[model samples]
Target: MTAATGKKVLERRLPDERATARLGEDIAMALRTGDAIALVGDLGAGKTTLARGVIRAMADDVSLEVPSPTFTLVQSYETRVPLHHFDLYRLGSPSELDELGLDEMLASGAALIEWPERAGDRLPEDVVAVELTHDGEGRLARIAGSGQAYERIARSLAMRDFLTGAGRGEATRRYFTGDASARSYETVTMAGEETRVLMNSPRLVLGPPVRDGKPYAEIAHTAQSVTAFVAIGRALAGAGVSVPEIFADDLDRGFLLISHLGSEGFLDAEGRPVAERCAAAAQLLAAIHARQWPSRLEAAPGFFHDVPPFDRDAMLIEAELLVDWYVPYATARPAGEALRAGFRAAWNAAIDRLDRAEKSLVLRDFHSPNIIWRADRKGHDRLGVVDFQDALIGPSAYDVASLAMDARVSVPPEIEKTAVDAYVAARREHGGFDESSFAEAYAIMAAQRNSKILGIFVRLNERDGKPAYLKHLPRIRNYLERALAHPALAELRDFYRRNGLIGGTA
Candidate 1:
C-alpha cells in the first residue's frame, strides 16, 4: 500500500523472530497515541507475536496478552501511553468494531489491528499498514505509514545493532577535565549545590579523547546527554559498585573526568585461573544482591506486578525471537504451534517454579563485560561491577546462570562447576541452606537464562538492527544445550532441538 503523500513505502524483511519483534518495537516507539497500525498476516505468520512485542515494549508495566484477540476482538492495556490491540477476525462488520470505541482509541495513543482487512475501509486514511508474508524460512513485512515519523524510526532501527561493525566511523575526542572545572558550554556539569559533598574524592572521569585527528568526546557529547551520564555514573558509585572513581562529574556543561579500571576483569585474570574468577564473581554478585535498591530503578514500560514473573516474560520474549527469526531463517519454516505451545508450557512452569522459590537480590546483568578486576580493601582480587541499574529481587540462581554461563565470555567446564559448587557451599556456610532444593532452583534458573539469552541475541540483530549480536548466538545456544544436558531439562532440550535451535548445531 502506498503512503498518502506517495513517499516510497519502506520494505523490510523480518528474517527471524528477533527481527519481527524489533520491527514491532520500532513501530511501537514511532507511534503516537493517535496513530494506528493495520497488520495482515496468516496463522503463525507472526501477527500476534509482533503485536505482543510492540505492546509490551511500548507499555512496559502493563500485561499484554497477545492471544489472537480474535475472540475478545480487542484487548486494552494500560501504557505510559494508551494503546488498543484489536483483532478483527471475530468481528463480522465495521459496526462491531465501532461499538468497541475503535475510533476513540485511534484518537489516543495507538490502535494495532490484526486481520485489519476484516475492518475494511473503516480505518482512517492515516493508518499504517504492516503486512507480513512468509518468505523461504523467514518473513517479509511491508510497512506503509502516514508520515515521516515512521521513516525516521525505521531508519534508526536500521542502524542500531548491539554488535554493529559501525564503530566510530568518524573521529572522536576524549576529555580528562578534572575536579573543580567550570561549566563551560562544551562541558557537562551537575550544578546543584544541594548535592552531596564528598571529602577528598580521588577518581576522575575523563573525556574528549582524540581519535583519528578528531576530539571524540566533543563529537559524541551534547549538553543534555553528558549530564545524564555523570548523574547515572555517580548514582551507581553511590549504590556501592566500584564505578570508575570519578574525580569530577559536571552534568550542566558536559565534562566528566573519571578513573579507569584496569583492562583485566576477574574473567580475564588467567593467572588467577577459572575457579578463582568464579568465586570472586560470585562474591560480587552476593554483595550487589545485598544492597538496598532505590525504587525508581525498576525497568520501564511495564508495571512492577506485570513484569514477567521473576523476569519470565523476558525469557519468553527471547524464545519467541527464536520462533520469529532464527528458526525461520535457519530452517526455512515457521515453528509449529505444538512446538511453541510445549516451549511456552516449559517457560510458564519455569516461571511458576521461580516465583515459588526463595527470592534474593538479583543483579540482572551479572556478566563479564560489566565487571572490573580489583583487589578489595582486604587485598584480595575482587570483582568490580557495572551495568546493574536494572537489578531486582529475584531467585539467587538467576545471577548464578548469568556468571557461570556468561554469553560474552566462556567459562571453562571445570570452572563453571566450581563456581556453582562454591556458591552452594557459601550458602551452606551461611547456615540457611537447602542443598537439594537449591540444586533444583539453579538448574531451572540456568535453563531460563539460556533461553532468554537466545531470544535477546536474535532480537538485538533482527529487531534492533544489531546483527553483530548474532556472533553470540552460538555461545548462547551452546549454553542452553549444556543446561539441557542436565537430566532435569531432558524434555526441554529435545523440544528446543526439534524446533530448530541447537547452537548452530544444525
Candidate 2:
C-alpha cells in the first residue's frame, strides 16, 4: 500500500478474523474525540467485524454487542469515550448524512463509519480511511489520513512496529486509561505468554514559555520524555524497590514494553484505602528516603538525566497555579496584583523551612492510584510503584503527605494517622529523624501540594475539558484545612482566610 497524495499510510495483513480484530484494537488505542475512522471495504470483507473490534476495544468490554447499522443507519454507544457506529450502505446520497447529525457526533466524541464512501466529499477532512480487501485467506487493510488523524495513524503504526521488534508482533492490544498528562498506556497479550504493558509516552512538545523563559512543564520539572521513567524505574529497581522491569524500548519514539504489575491496587473494591496497605506504602517510602540516591541517572548508553532539585522557584510557581486558575474560578475574577504578591510571599516564607528538612528521592505522586499491591512478595517489595517519571530531589515529607492525604481516595483520619506513624517509626529506626521539624515540614508540604491541586483541578476542568478532577475538590479542600491547622502555617492560613479563599478565622 502507498499514499496517493503525500498523506501517511500504513498497511497490515490480517491473516484471520482474530488478526483483523487485533488491528482494530490497536487503532482504537489511538482514537480521540473528533477522530473519524472511515471503514471502506467490499461486501463480506469483514468490515463490520473490524468495526465491532474497535468498539469493543474502546468500550473495554469484549462482550459488547455491535450490530451492523445497515438498517438503523447509525448506532451510538457510551463508552470510556462516546462512539458512533455509522453504516452508510443504505444511504442514497451524501446530503442525507446531514440528517444523521454527523457534525454533532464528531464534535462530542469519535466515529467509526462503515461504507463511508457513500458519503462522498461530505466526510470530514481529517477522516482516517481504512480500506480493506479480501486476501487469500483473510484481509488487507490500508490506513491513510491527513493532519491529526494522520499523526494518530502513524503513531499506531509505530506502536505496531515497536511491538513486532520486541517479539510480540501477534499480541493483542487493549486500551488502558490515560492520565491528565501526555502519556497513555495499553496492555498486550500473546498466546500462552505473560501479559506485558506498553507505555506510550511520546516526547513532550514544549509550549511557549510561561515563566522565566521556560514552558510550564519545564518550570514545574515535568518529565519531557520516557527517559525519565526508564532511568527512575531502573534506579528504584536497583535499590530493591518494586517497579516494573523494562523489557524493550524505542528511546527515540518514547515507547517501552514493561512488566505488567497486576491490577491489585492499594485500595479495596469499595474504593477505600486499606489500613495495612497504606501502612506498607508508608514503610516503602521510609525505605526509599533512607537510601542515598544519585542526582544523575543513566537512561541508556551515553544518555543521562540530571534530577532537578525541588527548589523555591518550582514550589512558588506551583503554588501560583492557585492564583492563575483557582482564584478566578472561586471568586469569578482574576487575582489582583496585591493578592498575587501576598500569595507568593506566604509560599516563599513557608518553603524556607524545607531547607532544614531531610531531602531524598521524592516520588511526587506517591498516592493510591500509582500503587499496586503484590500479595506474593515480601515486605516493601510487595508495593509496586508506577508513575514516578516526575520524581525529584525534595523533602521526604512531601511524599508522606501525598500518601497520607491522598487526593484520589479518602484516607480516614485514623488510617492517615496509622500511615504517618508507620513512616515515622520506620524512619526513626534509621536514626536522626527529627519528629518535631518533620511534622512542620509535612504540614507545609501538604498545604503547598493541595494548593497546587486546587488550581490544577480547575484548570483541567475549564481549560482541558476534563471535569473528573473537579470531583476531588472537596477532598483537597479538607486536606488543605487539615494542613492549615498546624501552627507553622498560621500566617499562610490567615492569608487564605483574608482572601476569602477558605472559611473561618485563622
Candidate 3:
C-alpha cells in the first residue's frame, strides 16, 4: 500500500507464462461486481494471455477458449461472476465505449479492458491498473489498485504468500464458490498432490452496535476469526466426523489450505434433494451429536477457543430479525411496538420449554450447500461437512431442523421424515435418547431458525446490495409454516397468524 495515494502496488518478475497465469488467478479471486481491470501494456506484452488466464479461472475451466476481442472489440462469458473482455485496439473512437455498454455491463459484473489508454478519461476512476512489460526475455508486472478491489487484491496476494509458505506456490488456483458470509473458496491444484481447497475467510469485523451496545454477530455468536474453524474442525475430526482435513493454516490471516472434500453434494442432477443422501447426512449428524463436546477447545497449542453458548439472548435477538426486517418487508409496514412486544413475549415463553432439551455442538448451517457426498466412502465417511466456523454449544435439535427444513433447496415432507427418522434411529440405538423431548426441541428450533433466515434474506436483499436471496423467501416461508405446526411453538404461531405471516388471517 502506497502511503501517499493509498494505491496497492505489487511488482513481480514473471519468469514464465505459468507465472503470469498464476498472477491472473490472484486477480480473479480479488474481483467483485462493478470492478474494472485496466490491462496496461504494449502489444505482445502478454495482455491477452493474462486476460485469458483470468477468464479461465473464473469459468472454473482450465481449457476454456478465450479469444481476444481484437476484431469484435468486446466478448463476454457467463460465469459465477460474469466478465467481459474488451480490446479497444480497433476502436473507432472513445464514444464507442458507451455504445459498447461498459457502464451497463459493470452494473451486474466486471470488465477487463485491454489498451485502456485509448479510452482516455472514459475509464472508471476506480480501476485496477496492471502494467506488463518486456523484462530480459521474461516479463515485469506491476499491479496497482485501491478501494475494495485494493483490499481484496492485497488479501488475495497474501493468500498466495500463505500457499507459497506452505510449499504449494506453483499450485494452480481456480475460483470455486462464495457463500452469503464473508468467506470465498478456491480450488488449488498441484501436480501429483491431492486437490486442496483454499478458504479465504478474513477475520470478521464487528459492525455498529444494534442492541445492548452489541453487534448482531455478537448476539448470534458468529465466529470472529479463523480460530473457530480450526478448533471446531479438529474437535469434529477427533470425534470421527468427516470434516475437511486442515493441511495448512494461517489462523490470524484467516486462510486455510484444507483437503478438497469432493464436489458431489446432497442434490441430485435435477437440483432436488436425494432421499438416500439426506438420510446419510442425518446419520452423520447423529454420529456427531452422540458424543459429548467440549465447550473450550485448544485451537492451537496453548491457545484455547471457547465455543460460545447459543443462549436465550442469542435466540431472541435472532428471532427479532423477523420483526425487524421480514415483518415490515412482508406487510409493507413497520411492526408496531405492541406487535413487537407480543412477539418477544411469545418467543420468551417458547424458549422456556428448552430447559429440558439436549445439548451438543450445533453446526448451525448443516444444509445441502455444506454437505459433500462421497459415494465411494462407507458409513459416516461417505459424507464430508464444511462451514462449521460458527459452531455453538446449543440444542442438538437445531441441526436436525436445519437439514430437514433446508433453506437452499426444497426438502419434501418424505425426505424431511427420512432425515428425522435416520437421526432418531441412530440416537436411539446409542441408548438414553429421549424422542419426545427432541420432537418439541426440533420444532421450536426449526421455527427459530426459519425466523432468523427470513430476516437475514431480507437484510441481504435490502441492505447488502444482494437481491438474489429474495428468490428464496417463499421457500423459507413454507419451511417456517411447517415448524409453526408444532405444539411447542403454539404462541409463536399465534403471533405469526395474527400478523398474517402464516395460515388463518383471522
Name the candidate that leads on lDDT. Answer: 3
Query: Relative to the unseen true structure, what is the C-alpha lDDT of residue 86 in candidate 1, on a scale of 0 to 100?
Result: 91
lDDT of 3 by residue, 265-291 (tens): 779998899989989989888888988
Q: Against the true structure, candidate 3 has what lDDT?
A: 0.90
Q: Which stretches of candidate 1 lie over 4 Å from their true place?
A: 1-172, 175-240, 244-259, 269-273, 290-311, 375-381, 463-467, 503-505
Cα deviation at 291, candidate 3, in Å, is 1.8
Off by over 4 Å in 3: 1-4, 504-506
* Per-model TM-score on C-alpha atoms: 0.49, 0.94, 0.95
Superposed Cα deviation of residue 413, candidate 1 (Å):
1.1
Minimal lDDT window, size 10, model 2: 1-10
> Each model's number of backbone clashes?
52, 0, 0
Mind sharing the TM-score for model 3?
0.95
Better of 1 and 3 by lDDT: 3
Worst 10 residues of 3 by lDDT: 497-506
lDDT per residue as tens, model 2, 1-506: 24467667778989999888888888888888889999998889888889998999888888988888899999999976789999999999999989999999988889999989899899898799999999899899998877886687678778988999999987878877588887888898988989889999999988899887889888888888899998998899999888999999988899999998888888888999998999999999998999999999999897788888888888888989989998898888899999999998898889887778989999899998899989898898789998899999999999999999999988888998999999999999988889998999999999999999999999999999888888898888889899998999999999998998777321
